[model samples]
Target: MSDTNAIGLHQGSASDLAAKLNELLANYQIFYMNVRGYHWNVKGPNFFELHEKFEEFYTDLLVKVDEVAERILTLGHKPVHAYSDYTTLSRIQEDKDVHDGEACVRGVLSGFQTLIEFQREILSVASDADDEGTASQISDYIREQEKTVWMLGAYLG
Candidate 1:
């Protein structure tokens, strides 16, 4: 039998893509919870603004988390679902009790930086594997987040 997966991609390449996507999912899960905490705990003069923005961020992250998990399934692999797995695999650690607006923004910026850099690596691997779907998805995320990073940096300045 041929070595291709159900989706017609080479099994080895699809497995590699799924592995990277799972890592991304873990990071997204951690980041999502962090933003949710930021939304709920933000205080001070900019509380309203930061709270609203954090809600937006976490909402988007939730969608991305689902999409990444589904993509892993499409690749014929299981996405890591347990909170234990997320905590173990994610590089973006939990940010607890960050009530300061600036601190929360900084935390978000750091998470975006981590995700963008990691996505770039995944993009390279996806490109090498000729996995255009994964590459395109990651490319869109990178493009959107580069702009966000710039805006967040401006906010901090």
Candidate 2:
């Protein structure tokens, strides 16, 4: 536990939140890597559009990855960044091979939706724990990922 708890934040076992945060961080890492892969491998008549979009998503993911890790650290937990941790903790599975352009968008949309749902659950747990900071962070993450999902879904259509 941290030496000082934020106001309205109860002194509860951070074990559960810590575990969830680690899982979220791991998922984010996998998602980011996959986005990067799409950015590099995307090819088709829509190449310019899809490739640029993938780059934008990857940039957002990079920022989000840092934000989540920092939030974990703020809670007095060590953020998981290693490949081993990501592989074990992440639920997001990587594509073995690049698919069609539309399929790539679908894949990313699936990932974003999965992440949004997981983060929403974590936020609920944080709220129940009376950890306002963590809850707020989860809300922010959910909002951002939800927007990403919408954009990706739109691209798929």
Candidate 3:
């Protein structure tokens, strides 16, 4: 609640795990932004289809970003915000000028897959730590990411 350093409580005491969760949240934000990029910039023969699908993905991811960061705060860790923080914490890389339609699709798909994997890993860690709330939060997100990935991949085939 206070910006006086949201660390050293619950799993935060386990700074390594807290840092890992922070990284995942940062990656989710980057992934969310990149999805927005795909939604805004995707154009080609499949414009109508990819456009709508990407919009759905970004919208879903936008919601999940809040959910993920809130879970971190609820776990007693500050939600990562600064770009410098994100660049250091996030495993995801944003796409700036992706032009190829398939490349866009591939990039998004890969991002979603990576997100799902990270969420699952974090959930597992949460479970191991007996952090049921965080585990449940990450579990819900993993489901959302999987569904989004499925929908995005379906468009390609």
Number of clashing pairs per prediction, in order: 0, 0, 0
Candidate 1's C-alpha lDDT?
A: 0.95
For model 3, the stretches where C-alpha displacement exceeds 4 angstroms are: 1-17
List model 1 lDDT by residue over 1-157, tens digit each: 8899887899999999999999999999999999999999988899988999999999999999999999999989999999999999898999997888899999999999999999999999999999888999999999999999999999999
Q: Candidate 2, residues 1-157: lDDT per residue as tens digits?
A: 5534544344454667878989999999998899888888877788888898888888988898898888777776789879888988999997647846887788789888989889888988998887888888889878877777777776666
Top candidate on TM-score is: 1
lDDT of 3 by residue, 113-135 (tens): 88888877777777777666677
The full ranking of all candidates by lDDT, starting with the best, is 1, 2, 3
Residue clash pairs of candidate 2: none
What's the candidate order when arranged by decreasing TM-score?
1, 2, 3
Candidate 1, which segments miss by more than 4 Å at Cα?
Answer: none
- What overall lDDT goes with each candidate model? 0.95, 0.82, 0.74
Candidate 1, residue 141: CA error in Å? 0.5
